[model samples]
Target chain A: MTETRISRRFAECAAAGRPALVTFVTAGDPDLETSFEILKALPKAGADVVELGMPFSDPMADGPAIQAAGQRALHGGQTLAKTLDMVRRFREIDAATPIVLMGYYNPIYVFGSERFVVAAKAAGVDGLIIVDLPPEADDELCLPALAAGLNFIRLATPTTDDARLPAVLANTSGFVYYVSITGITGSATPNATRVAEAVGRIKRHTALPVAVGFGVRDAATAAAIGRDADGVVVGSALVAAIAASLDADGRATAKTVPAVAALVGDLASGVRTARVGAR
Target chain B: MNTTPNSLRNGPDDRGFFGIYGGRFVAETLMPLILELEQAYEDARNDPSFKAELANLSTHYAGRPSALYYAERLTEWCREKTGGKFGAEIWFKREELNHTGSHKINNCLGQILLARRMGKTRIIAETGAGQHGVASATVSARFGLPCMVYMGAVDVERQKPNVFRMKLLGAEVTPVTSGAGTLKDAMNEALRDWVTNVENTYYLIGTAAGPHPYPAMVRDFQSVIGTETKEQFFAAKGRLPDAIVACIGGGSNAIGLFHPFLDDPSVAICGVEAGGHGIDVENGHAASMTGGRPGVLHGNRTYLLQDGDGQILEGHSISAGLDYPGVGPEHSWLRDTGRVTYVPATDKEALDAFQICSRLEGIIPALEPSHALAQVLKMAPTMDKSKSIVMCLSGRGDKDVFSVAGHLGETM
Candidate 1:
């Protein structure tokens, strides 16, 4: 197992005195070729870490935007193998950016968990964020991924009180994804004051970097969360940008890559400018 | 006090797993809520007041101890129709006589009580055939909790009477139009709503499905049907019946009747699923145990109708309640362990049994239990006269009258 790229990426962002900007894209939105092109374009567009979504038939935790993106990806014949292939392709050009594959766990379970983990490491994937696998069931994928040198990120929500935080963070590695809101992604914006408090509480427990996501649709919201978190994750909003850039027939337009890149660039600027005075 | 038979009751271990099936396969956002629910259900299970109040409601409000009547005429009709090779006695565990006209109310009452204890202010549920929706709406109205029921648009059209019944019970019915407009889609929408409103809402799942605590809790509530049948059968015949049968939609009613008899080695248990057109077609039948493979869906690992790509396929059934791609995870466990036998009842078979039972026994059963009766009608004629079978008539047929009329090409 190779060393994870996530920890180094966060350390690099810390040295640069800025919160890392993390972007999310479905692996095969519209089609495989266009999706890989968008993936390659994300780094130059200022994304520090890229979270690629492996589309599943049912993404229960997602909002309408990501759900639609996944539906498009699935309609275009995206599978776990294809998602890994896209990662293999993205690693060819840029080996520095940490790539986290995020989705539900059924596909991996169907694809055989051990086989998927080995394949993911070989494909240059850095981390995993399976939304449905809680810490109580960590041995299902988390431990295996950790053994394979991939960070298995766990999500802590507002409902996660002090009594449950320890278990939630027991085996979590590389980073802790603090879901900024109680609802699905893109549904409601998080209160930065509450998020700061949650972040402070979580930092007291683990030394892992904490990234905030959910309901972060624009640069302004990203900046607000970036003030207190180690990283700012913008997922549904970027997926929505890709959706908006699609042609009338739902195919990728010429502006698809540019549209996603422009949003990531703005978000990157927001994260970079946050917490200058305090830090 | 752990009324389950010692042999087959030790499932779901500590983590709510029944063998390889039945775990909390929900989103991380719902983990806290699920843990809270698990604790709350445990506390309520131990509280005497909770049991007392639930019992009082069962006896006076929901009409518990639904009759176990000998279907003498139906038994005779079967014997005559099947050439008298077998003259097995048939009995009907009359869950249809319950206040909401189904076994669904049993689980609803128990869940609403748990919801009240947990301090939840609102309730939400998903319905397929609308029996569970009506039952849930009835309890919400009784407990003064604002209720919302998600029903597939297709089911709302086919089960209009139940839709009207739910509305009359003061529940707001939201028609879900996604993913073939069926039970599975309705559940997906309900889960979405639950994940969105996790603070003040209690998702009152109507079946023995979903994540942990649900399959077990719903079975505990519905086990009243089996418990009552056990007592009544012993009182009537001085012994337990040779076999018990029930239909498996999400398998709530079937598990209700089967769980109590699971330890009795001499008592055979069979679950009948709706085989819509046939089991061979790509999109036909809700016979997950017979025609499907084990997979994860709606927060539990169960036998589901899916394709090679792991995409869940829609199931077809004449009964809206049984038209789901997945069975309850516990049923999958039971099937694999060989504790229970699961079979399929085709549309034509259930329809003919529906008409025959109505004519012979003067009871119009819901289409769900008609599937069970279809299987019983076939199996009863093959058994000796000394042997007996009890079928759970899970619901009344009033709500299904319109659909039956349409299917039979008769005008209302």
Candidate 2:
């Protein structure tokens, strides 16, 4: 596999004093058009990385807000093809930002594991974050992803202590996504000091840049966590914010994208400020 | 709401919904398999050769066309109750008449057959009540395939008889110790086994959940219930029943009974979920669709019992079969689409129905089915006198006799 256009930019963004800004939005949200806009707009709005959520009917790693968002996307005719197409459109517009498609692994597996990788690479997907795939079955994704020059990002939770970290890292490419809590996504409370402590521990094992996610909601939380992490991954909060801008049926009735974009811009500033403060 | 096209033949449609309940809510991991299954099931179900093969197996191997006797005395007793699953045109699918003594044989047989076509030899399953395990074991034996079953440690103790039956049928039962040490744990273990053995093994999931194709496929096999009921009801009454009802666990049996008649707008479909104590408090309930959020579990995202922080919550119910944290993805889609209405039944009500049906009808139902009976009894009597209701009696009560004996004030 070759380096994705996005993953390389992520490294560049991390090299600067500015912390990486990773934004997650479910594809086919409200509708496929909005999903495309969200995907295309993230990079311009100060987001160095974007996790395009493949709308799953069941999202175990998401809160109600994200789950509802996924359901809305699915209902609005978002399929694996459409999600990849959205990524392709983003690739056409911006070739620098890292685009990672995040969701459970079953949908991808259902969509033709081999075909998915080929199409994903063609659509300009830089990395993937499958919540349920274990390192034991890395061949289901990792090998194919690597073959396509795509990065297979691994999630290491608090449970992935010393014994598991190395194996997870060995199979993982791109960067390591550190789960800040003992439980599933959207469960952990933001504890910056504790997260920073954990980040220091992870830094010793793998040279891979570590990003802490799960409870990085507000700018303060993202900034605090950014002090130790190479990147701060905020998902549920962004989905929650986008959820508010939607009508009951999940349509964006106004210029909510600009508001969402501004929020990301502000959060990006916080990450950079935190990096500076840490220095 | 009843607009989802009803397929008289089995298999998932293009959209994967078993008449608006079953659809693909999977990640990218299993898309190919789901798509392959849809095509395989569609082709096989339509082919005369395949139909004949399955019919022969059901008739000779698993014993199809189970009896539909009228529980006269039970109907009279239900005459005073609110609803009527045992009364009216109600007919037990007589799934217990099968080899493993449950309707699970229908699904296991279909899946094993499908696996054979896919050239998969090994079979892996997750069992709670052990009914599905026993069925899977029987199918693997009939097909001469290896079998593995994951059971919750707690379930292994309470359902020891079924565990023994499974082993006797040549299936290895592995006790799982994750999560709540119950159905959810078993499910996780099964998923681990599948992911580890993806090449030569087929995960024969027992419920109508887990990623794509499963929720739809399980219903396809179980759709024999709806097909049989539709034919039998018309034969008995010269018309279809006004309503059809069943207990929903992973919504498999309910979907099975509802799929055939889904296109009939005049017919209503009702599903009963495990409501634990009652509906007032969502606490301690296994009613995923009623009191759960959408979350992924056991390879598929669906309605799940989760906490404020999105941690999946283990559910509670008197019946081991109903004690699951999440539902099949199809059920979540169905709830969202308003195609089928899901109601909650408390453990007490199920227990009450268990004892009442046994004493009144001389036929005991499994605790899971008793939940459906509870709902049927709740509102049947209030229905129009001319209107008739048919509840799919998924399985017999023999296996449940032990579990409910204690709750029914009978010594085990």
Candidate 3:
């Protein structure tokens, strides 16, 4: 059987004795050019998968951190098309890295879901993490992405019990995005062992890989979870880092990229250490 | 019940547009937030846990299953009104019993929860009749969230009870001065609030108009009405009603009543618009359905009550609720599709219903819904005696009594 591109990408990362490092960046944050630079810098700094957040006003699950980043991005003239153009540009330099466009579905649906998926695939997005789209609501996004050969990454939180796991797993095309806690993005404390238990539980359902996110702030937390999980997603923390640059001074500054990239590198190293059994 | 459970949404690439009506028409600044709202709404709407939460709030907090009442007295009232020939049976699915005493609570509760889910702490909304504002403020109080209600200065004076109600509900009432000081102006003010406070605030639109997902999504949230009514009627009479009638302000409540009845070809759906006075457009009626042409008013391009040059015309109604310059995009779609019929009731007729309901049924109805009741009085009498009609009493008449007193020359 021909393994899907996401499965192939996961296999490559797994075979390298390293966990995949997924970084989340609000598109056009601070400025579009600066955001492009930040995206360009991630792969070199050891991010295997990059998640570009489409800035939106009402991000339901986002904490104060991501919310502020979204404000900045929106203020910076980031749009659905602009974010896609950003990806289309980033793909030119970084083709090997799996780019996961993770955000809300409204923009994509607004852009015409079929056109969005085809364009996203053409621009080099491997998967989609539409935070809450599942089987019942899958027709608008998930099914279309599956047909377009883009992985619809499903999120499984603590709320996802035995009754829900099978359906969630079924809706997923790429590696499952397991939300570690029940709360919003920045509210949870990192529970890697619990995440590992979740990953173990999920493994029984499918051969598909699992990534643990939400409150995986620092390297220690990331490694603890990445030690057992296939991929690690750092979103609100990076957003918090970016938000620090805004400060009392309204204009966004450069500390945004380094603050997040340095943490990403550190976490990437931790995951590598765990893979080599150095931990 | 071979329940395939067809969701109310159209297919993807469908744009949620029933036809050429619903589309996202917003400023560049609001583009992201609107999209986010669309996405979050889709997700939470689909998520079982989220649905359970909304359902819990609906059943427990919103006091759902707000009695499908058989108006036995009103049925005989129709019998006498129609010369005792073709008498009719009327059942009102009383949405007025919901929290805040209006069907607007249903939409406000759902949207407020969506805002909360998205970590939005502040809610801003525009109100004309103040039913939606009162509903929004109530939900804001219930959720412990800060809320802002924008009302046209004209509406401010007319709907004083509602303005006072909003203030008591812990919401800041911003009186809008622009554009005839009415619903459009209030909407402009609310949009300004959204643009300024886009980060922490969620603009809870009062009606089933505006951008793509909103018109459809709001209808979806409010669709629990038709869904409940269909079931309740089935339990009561073992069948669907011959007609579903509701008044249209921005057409939210009417859409709620009409959406479930869309697939039922046999069930006639009628929407009553406020015909303020006079016979035509120059008379200052808020009959968006009748006086409106295909034009943009609020967000989505739809049938708008406009002047000769395509400028949206000012609207007037005794009921501040019905005094709107435009209808929801989906309502325009429904109008064109002929799936649902849009009718007009003058302010005098609405007031007449207000008096009749209070006199006959001992139920004083909100002015917004009085139009529907008035229309029911007009049309139900013309229908077969055995034919059942369901009127969506969107709210109680408590808010309108004082306002109506001034009109009827009663000093109390």
Candidate 4:
């Protein structure tokens, strides 16, 4: 397979002798304009790769924080077309940072999977992480996406046993996202020891880089998890930051973008120092 | 309609697609557990002892083989409406007479037994109007296991009696307040619970929906309704009825009654959807097949009420039980294949049928099945007098009397 932006970014991070800091923020959150500012500021604040959440009305896999972010975005009239446009705008300024669109499959299915891939590739999306479409339903979007040159990133959870690991990794590209916990996002604290073991186990199965996410909040946890994994992903915490900085009316205030950027800077510093004193 | 050589009963191919409708569309964390459930269910299906235990429970515990009664008064009223020119003889598969006052108990019993066989200790379920919640709590109590039922807060307030019934049965009722606080929201909360507690929890889905094994498995368990209806209708009328009708929420009762008659070319199958006001009213009905299109939600690709962005829309219905955005994937497949006809019954029509049936036949039907009864009232008057129709009285109205009274402007 040819190397894409995601692969090249991971390679760059590895060459720097540190894990990458992956930050997730819902697109069009608080409003389309503020969300774009946050997206553009992520890489500068040390987010190596960005996961843009396409807010859906029902985000079953999401916990309370991300769910609220999605609702806020939708209440502000965020549509799939608008989300894609936000990506297009983000790509205009930044061409180096890899961007992955993460959400459920229905919106993409409604958008026409073939059309979505073409449009997504044109809009500068590097990969996808559709939580609901497992390996069993690969024909729905995974293959078409791979054929269109967009990386199809797959999530490996704690419940994915060794027997089922191969199928989950069969068509996966970009990087393998190892969910640190068995529950929904931001529900539980992932034990660093177990996450490292899981990352090692996944590494034994494939040559792709492994990124650990779910329940990652502070820089300490990020650094702990980044010690063994190739990348550290933080989503619910960043979304929670946006929620906290919002005004009483739930509209975006002056602090929303800077609040998320500050958190991302801290998490990036954590990842940069993850391997400094350990080995 | 010519009967094809192929059997309609056989479906949900090896990968669980009922002709591009049903597939396992869940998170990877739940994938292994679902596969485990499929295997355990397959093993139990082939084991004779499993069938024997389920049969025993159905016969003695759930009061199975619920009577198939001829609605003579209802039929006479239809004849009066048509001025004796046309009226099909009407019969009812009395599932409301079952233990929990609905066909929900039949599926509950089968699933609970399977849960025990799989060594699952905790039980979780999602309910709309609490009929399924009551049934799930009943089985959990009978088996000495703890149960948790997720219900929309709106339904909790509206269906107070059934909520109390569930509480009395030692079940925890969690009121979900998100997304209009209705059935779809309750289902989303239940999925969250299942994902969080996959180690020992068994999600006893109330309807014939959800992902792969669930749609097919729930249908197999509920198929007992059709299997019994076939024999009883044959015994009472000496042949099959001209048609059969049932209401569709998640389509459990309808599929239960229609599965056995799928290949019976002589028996026409019709499903009634809950049209809150009318199909044309914006976001005012739960008629997925009538006013919606196919989209993925709640782990299955089915007909759903979604917006232009594929965001699921909150559906409205006077009967809280029928308020859901999506229909079962099997029903979607059936609709596509033209194996069954689907129609909509407005809340006004259902309310009218509820009162007419209560006064004439002395059987107060639940609002869910009243939709089916409304469709029956419309169709019976149009058919020839010699023809016959059987409708599944899926639930009793004792639980709905309070809501019905409020709707009728009565203080009670």
What are the runs in model 1 whose C-alpha is more than 4 Å off? A1-3, A277-279, B1-6
- Compute the interface RMSD for candidate 1: 1.3
lDDT of 4 by residue, A214-241 (tens): 9999999998999999999999999999
Q: What is the TM-score of chain B alone in each candidate?
A: 0.98, 0.89, 0.96, 0.98
> lDDT per residue, candidate 2, A167-232, as tens digits?
767878888888786444455576888888888888889777788887777788888888888888
- What is the DockQ of the complex in model 3? 0.02
C-alpha positional error of residue A28 in candidate 1 after TM-score superposition, expressed in Å: 1.6
Instruction: Give one digit per residue, the lDDT tens place, for model 2 in B1-412.
Output: 1343343334345555434344454322233445566677767777787778888898898887766555556555656564443335344555556667777888888888888988888999999888888889999998999999999999998788889888998889999765457887787667655543556778899988875577777877888878887887788778978888888877777877888886677888788999887656656889988987665456555777865434456778888888887777656766676767899999999888888888877777888889998887776656654667777677777777677767657885
Better of 1 and 3 by TM-score: 1
Write the residue-wise lDDT of candidate 3 on B11-124 in tens digits: 223454556666655433355567678899889987898888889999998899888988888788888876889766888989999988999988988898899999998989
Off by over 4 Å in 3: A1-279, B1-14, B281-283
In model 2, where do residues sit more than 4 Å from their true spots? Answer: A1-128, A132-279, B1-39, B80-91, B408-411
lDDT by residue for model 1 (A1-279), tens? 234688888999988888889898899997999999889988898999999999876677888899889889988988899999989988888889999999987788878789999999999999999988999888789999999888899999888889899999999998999998878878898899999999999999999999999988888888889988999999989989999999898999999989988998899888877876865
**Per-candidate RMSD, Å:** 1.8, 14.2, 11.6, 1.5
Q: Candidate 3's residue-wise lDDT over A1-279, tens digit each?
A: 347656776798899876788888888886788888888888888888888888754454565677667768776778877888888898787667778887764456456778889988887788888753444456667889888888888777665666667876786877888878755677667676778888899899988888888787878777778788898888887777777766576565657668767877887787777655544
* Worst-scoring 10-residue span by lDDT in model 3 chain A: A131-140
Q: Estimate each model's TM-score.
A: 0.97, 0.62, 0.60, 0.99
What are the Cα lDDT values of the candidates?
A: 0.91, 0.75, 0.79, 0.94
State the DockQ, from 0 to 1, for candidate 4.
0.89
Candidate 4 off by > 4 Å: B1-5
CAPRI-style grade of the A/B interface in model 1: medium
**lDDT tens digits, residues B96-147, model 4?**
9999999999999989999999999999999999999999999999999999
**Model 4: what TM-score?**
0.99
